[model samples]
Every structure is written in C-alpha cells, then in structure tokens.
Target: MIRKTLALLLLGLFAAPLWAADCSTTIEGNDAMQFNQKTIQVPKACKQFTVTLTHTGKLPKASMGHNWVLGTAADEPGIIADGMKAGADQNYVKPGDTRVITHSKLVGSGESDTVTVPVAKLKAGENYAYFCTFPGHAALMKGTLTLAP
Candidate 1:
C-alpha cells in the first residue's frame, strides 16, 4: 500500500503542470514593431486566460512602445483609430472604451505586462484580434485569437 501511494503521488505531481499550463500564454513583441505570433487559441475549458506580453528590444517607449489590445475583428479599426486620438499618456487606448475586451499596459524595450481575459466573454465562432495600439504599430503588430474546443 505504501509503494502504491508513492507512485500515485508522483503521477499527480507530473500531471499538475500540464493542467495549469492550459489557461496561460506568452507572446513576444520586439523592436521591429512586430509580434512573434499571429494567432492565439483560447481553450473553452478555461474560466480565465492570461496573456503575457514581453518587449524584447532595447528602444525607449517614446519611439517603440508596444501593448496588447484585444477586441472583435470588426472593432479593431475603430479601436485603433480612437486609441490614436487618445494619445500616449493613456497607453494609446481610449479611456472607458467598451469595445475593448482586455489589454496590457504600454510597454517599451525590456519591459513586460500581462492581461487576463474572461473566457465567458468569448464566443466560439466569432473572430477576435489583438494588436499593439502604439501609433502606427498596429498595422504590422496584429494577430487573431479564437476560442477553441
């Protein structure tokens, strides 16, 4: 009985990490004004999902700031436009924007931030997009996100 219990405990320990890994992800943005990934998959089983944005460059925020913004694909253009009007002090995201689902704070080279999004806010068949709201960066720094089965 003692040996059996020890084996079961080791098995549980090994499986713990896989369970935890399902609800979180990391995305990297660089000085080139680009995000390394173009797509993200959110599992339906997750109650909440976290996105960690890492700026791996050496430039200052004024010249090369990056942020992670999430919204429906149809809302992206308007959000980006309005965010530009909102300006840098607001992290380029319009204050009290209802269209935004989740977003990370503006970050510059060597900086990082994370945003948590509730899975319930997502629809399985709808198209969602994520982008950096820093001025002209959204043109190249955008990607698709989807809820997965």
Candidate 2:
C-alpha cells in the first residue's frame, strides 16, 4: 500500500503541469486577411481569458487592418454587418454592441492588441465565434472558441 501511494503521488506530481490552466493565447493575422488559429479552448478553471492579436504582415490599417471580435455564432452575421457600417474609426466593431463578448483593437502590420474575455459569460455547449470585422474578411479570418469541460 505504501509503495502504491508513493507511486501515485509521483505520477500526479509529474502530470499536474500537463493540466495546468492555460488562460491566454496569441493569434496572428496577416496581410492575406488570415488568422493563424482556428480554434481556442478556454479552460474551465479560468475565470477570465486573454487573447492577443498580432498583425504579422506589412500593411497599413486602412488596407489590411485586423481586429479580433467575439460573439455567439448566431450573432456573428449581424455584428459583422453593423461593424462594416461603423467603419475603421470604430475598430470595425459597432459601438455599444452588447452582443460582442469582447474584442481587440484594430491592428496594422507589426502591431498588436489584446482583449480579455470573461469566462463567466461563456456557456457550455454554446458556439462562440471570433473573427476579424474588417470588410470582407469574415469569410477567412474567423474561428471558434469554446469553454472546455
């Protein structure tokens, strides 16, 4: 029994780091209007999560700006439509849009921005969408984020 207990404790010590909470991630957007990651998992243990958006291409905000926008999958279409109308001055996100869970500021080549997502706002089994609200970029610069079980 003593040997078994010690072995179990040793295994746990080695394995703990594997499950260590990851509460943040970095995503890259390029001149081609693309995001490097297609999926993000928010560990349940995290009360909040941070996402950093980095623009890796050489381009100006007027032409190739990228911003990270988050909303429920169902809210994505309306959000994008309104963001288009809101224009570049608004970071491609509509003002006072409650549907948006969180968003990063518009970023140009070599620039970066970060946004914090409240984990409490996430619901299990609900589909969350993240995308760049730049005009005509949603089709390519989009991904899903989910709360881990």
Candidate 3:
C-alpha cells in the first residue's frame, strides 16, 4: 500500500502540470531594436495570460529602453502615436488608455518587466498587436497576438 500510494502521488504530480495550459510567455529585446518573437497566442482556457519582457542589451533606458504594449491592431497607430507623446516617464504608454489591454513597464539593459492580460478582454476573431512604444521602435519591433480557442 505504501509503494502504491507513492507511485500514485508521483503520477499525480507529473500529470497535474500536463493538464494545465501554458499561460505565460517571455519576450526578449536587444539593442538592435528587435524582439525575439513576432507573435503570441493566449490560450482561451487561461483566465489570464502573462507576458514578460527582458532587455538583453547593454544600453541605458534613455537610449534603448524597451517596453511591451498590447492593443487592437487598429489601435496600434494611435497607441504608438500617443505613447511617443507620453514620453519615457510613462513607460511610453498613454496614461489610463482604455484602448490598451495591457502593457509592461519600460525596461533597460539587463532589466525585465511583466504584464498580465485578462483573457476575458480578448475575443477569438479580433486582431491584436504588441509593440515597443519607444519612439520609432514600433516601426520595426511589433508582433501579432491572438486568442487561441
């Protein structure tokens, strides 16, 4: 009975993780003004999704700061436009912007930040996009996101 119980415990432990969905992802930014990934998918089973952005460059925030911003594809332009106006102090994101679903704080070399997105805010067929809000960074550093059914 003892051996059977131990075996069952181990099996439960191993199987528990397999039954859960992956609800988080990591994205890396470099001094080259680029992101390691160009797309993300949020599992519908997840109540919330997390995104972690890591700056792998050697520059300071003033020069090559990076941030992750999420919004509808149609809102990308307006978000980027106003984010530039909002400046670095605001993580380059407009304050209290309802159009934004979620965003990570600005990060510099060797720094990192995370943002949580509520899955309820996402729809299956809507077009979503993420990008860096540092001035012209969005022109090159951007990606698409989708809610996976």
Candidate 4:
C-alpha cells in the first residue's frame, strides 16, 4: 500500500502541469486582413486572460491597421458599426461601448497590442467573437473565443 501511494503521488506531481491552465496567447494580423487563429479556448482556471495582437505584415495603420475587438457574436454588428463612427482616433472601438468586453489598440505592421479579459465576464456556453475593426476587414479578420469547461 505504501509503494502504491508513492507511485500515485509521483504520477500526480508529473500531471499537475498538464492540468494547469495557460492564461495568455498571441494572435497575428496581416496586411491581407487576416488573423492567424480562428479560435481561442480560454482555460477556466484563469482569473483573467491576456491576448496579444501582433501585426505581422508590412503596412501602415492608415491602410492596414488592425485591432482586437471582443464581444458576443450577437453584438458584433452593432460594435462594428459604432466603431466605424468612433473612427481611427478611438482605435476603431466606440468609447464606453458596453457591448465591448475588451479590446486592444490599433496596430500597424511590426506593432503589437495586448488586451486583458476578465474571466468572470465570459460564459462557457455563449458565443464570443474577436475581430479587427479596420474598415471592411471583419470579413476576414475574425475568430471565436470560448471559455473552457
């Protein structure tokens, strides 16, 4: 019984890291108006999560700017519409938009920005989406984020 318990403890120790959650990720946006990742799974163990957006292409913000925007999939249209009105100075996100859960600043080629999302705000079964608000870029620069069970 002592030997069995010791072996089980060793196994548990080795497996602990696997069960631990990763609380951050990096995503890339390019000149072609594309995002490198299509889906992000936020681990439930995280109290908060950080997403880093890197603009990987060679273009200026005026023409190929990219920013990370997060909201419910149902709220996407309204957010985008308001963001456009908010204009570039606001990083293409409306000021104080309640629909926006979190967002990163607009970035150009070789630039990057990060956004922190409170895990408490995410619902496991709800559809959450992330996208770029650069004019007309949403058609391609978009992805889904979900809270892990």
Candidate 5:
C-alpha cells in the first residue's frame, strides 16, 4: 500500500504542471524582427487568456522595441497604420483605440510584458490576429490567434 501511495504521489507531482498549464503562453521576439510563434489558440474553457512577450535580443527599446497587440484580423491594417502614426510614445498603439482587444507594454532586450485577453471578447470561427506595432515590424511580426472550440 505504501509503495502504491508513493507512486501516486510521484505521478501527481509530475502531472501538476501539465494540468496547470492552460490559458497562458510565452512568446519570444528576437532582434531579427521575428516572433517565435506563428499561432496561438485560446481554449474555450478559459475565461481569460494571457500572453507574455519576451524580448530576447540585445538591443534597446528605441532601436528594437517589441510589444504584443491583439485585435480582429479585419482591424490589422488600420491598426498598424494608426500605430505608426502614434509612434513610440504610445508604444506604437493609438490612444483609445476601440479595435484593440488587449496589448502588452513595449519591451526591449532582456525585458518582458504580459497582456490578458478576455475570452469573452473572442468568438468561435472569428479571425483574430496578434502582432507587433513597432513601425514596420508588423510586416514580419504578425501571427494568428484563435478561440479553440
């Protein structure tokens, strides 16, 4: 009985992390203006999803800043345009932009930021996108995000 109990405890310990590992993700951005992930799927069981952005490059924010921005796919072009006009002071995101679902703060090398996306804002079968709004970075730093059924 003791041996069985020990096996169960060990199994539980190893399984804990996997069981607790839903609804959040970490994505890395490098100096080459690329994101490590191309897609993210939010589980329908979650009330909110979190995305953490890490800048793995060695540059400063002024030269290679990165931020994660989320919005509907339809809003991407307009958002990127407005963000470019908004510039660095606003983290490249327009102020009071209703199209934005959520976004993280700008991060430089060795820095990180997190954003929480309310799952209620997402709908099944709807197209969603996440991208970096740092000037021309969006061209190479964009990805698709979806609500998983």
Candidate 6:
C-alpha cells in the first residue's frame, strides 16, 4: 500500500508542471489575414512566457507573410507604422524598436515561429496588444493579451 501511494505521489508531482503550463500559448494565422484567437492570457506565476505563431495557410511569405509582435496597446500604432517603414527584410519590425516587448521572425505558410517574453516586463493592469506586422495585416491580425492573476 505504501509503495502504491508513493507511485501515485510521484505521478502527481510529474503532472503538476503540465497543469501549470498556462504560460505558453499558440496563435494561428491564415491566408485570409486572420488570427485564430482574439485574446491571450499570461499567467503571473511564470517567470517567462512563450507565444508560438503558426501560419496555416498555403500562401508564400512574400505575398502573405506574418509575424507576431507584442507591445502596449498604445504603442501598437506607432510600432506598426515604423515597422512598415522598416519593410519586409526587417520582418516588418523596426530593427531596434524599444517599444516591442517581443516578436517572432516573419513566417510563411505552413511555417511557424515562437517568441519568449519575460514576465517581469509585463504589468498586471496594462493593456497589451499583439499583432502581425506584415505590411497592412495589423488591421485584421490583432489581439489582446493580459497578465493573469
């Protein structure tokens, strides 16, 4: 009975991390210029969080490229504008944008990328926004993100 109880305890211990994995999330982009999710929550308990962006469409990057960019909602417009100026070679992001908290590399259809954001930089009450910086894609590819209690 003791051995069985210990085995169960060990199993529970191993399963704890899986249950606590609210730190990572996946977002999908399609040819239609849409993101699968409109909102994302990052758990405060995590020291860092990861966002994986996947392009499910079949279009090539040049015609329909996508990238995940994170910043405060207020900073989005300026960032997007600057990103546009930076153009495609820079993944539609300014080369040294301090406003960008984290961003993934530009990706094409059937491709994916991940960006890691440090939790310490996130404020609980601030409104955070995430979007694809592919030229004019921001209008249809934006989403909100928040820090969870």
Best by lDDT: 2
Better of 1 and 3 by lDDT: 3
Where is model 5 more than 4 Å wrong at Cα?
A: 1-21
Between prediction 2 and prediction 6, which has the larger lDDT? 2
Off by over 4 Å in 3: 1-6
Write candidate 6's Cα lDDT for 48-143 as tens digits: 999999999999999999999999999999999999999999999999899999999999999999889999999999999999999889999999
Model 3, residue 81: what's the lDDT? 92
| Backbone clashes, candidate 5 | 0
The order by descending TM-score is 3, 1, 6, 4, 2, 5
Candidate 5 matches the true fold with a TM-score of: 0.88
Model 5, C-alpha of 76: deviation from truth (Å): 0.1
TM-score of candidate 4 against the unseen true structure: 0.90
Tens-place lDDT per residue, model 4, 75-129, is 9999999999999999999999999999999999899998899999999899999
The sequence of per-residue lDDT tens digits that candidate 2 reaches over residues 5-57 is 99999999999989889899999999988999999999989999999999999
Measured on C-alpha atoms, candidate 4 has an lDDT of 0.95
TM-score of every candidate relative to the true structure: 0.93, 0.89, 0.93, 0.90, 0.88, 0.92
| Candidate 6 stretches greater than 4 Å from native | 1-4, 7-11, 14-19
lDDT to native, each model: 0.95, 0.96, 0.96, 0.95, 0.94, 0.95
Candidate 4 residue runs with Cα over 4 Å from true position: 1-16
Cα deviation of 22 in candidate 5 (Å)? 0.4
Candidate 5 lDDT, tens digit per residue, 108-134?
Answer: 999999889999989999999999999
| Model 6: lowest-lDDT 10 consecutive positions | 16-25
Clashes of each: 0, 0, 0, 0, 0, 0
